[model samples]
Target: ELKVEQNPLFLSMQEGKNYTIYCNYSTTSDRLYWYRQDPGKSLESLFVLLSNGAVKQEGRLMASLDTKARLSTLHITAAVHDLSATYFCAVGGLTGGGNKLTFGTGTQLKVEL
Candidate 1:
């Protein structure tokens, strides 16, 4: 079984602020991904961190990976109202004789004013 965890299950941020979301896994994984979901919408793939030190960014969001530590992070730069959403991190690896994605519980970010 694969287990993924994320910290700060809920976040209330103000515009022009910054924050980071952390993700940790119980087992080894070569793949980690970041996704965002708006209310009443489907999850949107934001970044795919495949190798160690892999980092990706777009707009106000940045994501990095550390395979050795089974940790990943999503950093929010200059938070804005439009950045409000639920973020998720999924760790993928061989499991049950196949590849599976273990998703974190998600961190809901609320940017106001």
Candidate 2:
């Protein structure tokens, strides 16, 4: 079984600062994904990186995947109070029938002004 790990499990940043969240996996994975969640709410898909060097960005969030390195990253640009949420990365578990998402520990970000 592959293990997914995320760094800086807890984050506190100013509203105008910038930061990056890191995600690493144990084994070979064909895909990488990022999601965001608010307290007691469902996850919102942020990015899905299916290939090496795949990158996606929206507003203050940006995600990228490097298959060869078995790593992914989520970057917050000019963090905002509204961006405070838990970010997660998921990888592997492709069983042909469907994808079983294995999520990371999750990074909790708090943007204080």
Candidate 3:
């Protein structure tokens, strides 16, 4: 079975700060995805890491994957109020029939001014 563990379940930071969220998986995975969700909204895809050492960045968020270590990281640079949301990392692995995704508990970020 594939299990994912994410650190810093809750993060409170000031605007213009930087932080990183980590995701560790128990088994090998084919793909990794990062998602963000607001208080009352559905999840929004942030980034997708296709291969080992793959990195993607948009705006203030950056995501990277290390398939060799079964790890993924989401980095936030110059965080702002609009970046406050719950972030999730999902890993896709080959199961019995098809690939399945297992999500982490999530890291809640609160950016303050």
Each candidate structure's TM-score, on Cα atoms with residue i matched to residue i, is: 0.94, 0.96, 0.94
Error of 1 at 36 (Å): 0.6
Reference-based TM-score, model 1: 0.94
Q: Pick the candidate with the highest TM-score.
A: 2
Better of 1 and 2 by lDDT: 1
Segments of candidate 1 deviating more than 4 angstroms: 95-98
Query: Poorest 10 consecutive residues of model 3 by lDDT?
Result: 92-101
Put down candidate 1 lDDT per residue, 3-73, tens digits, no spaces.
89999899998999999999999988879989899999999999998899999999989999999999999
From the highest TM-score down, the ranking of the candidates is 2, 3, 1
Give per-residue CA lDDT, model 2, range 41-100, as digits (tens). Answer: 999988888999999999988998888889898999999999999999999677879988
- As for TM-score, the candidate ahead, 1 or 2, is 2
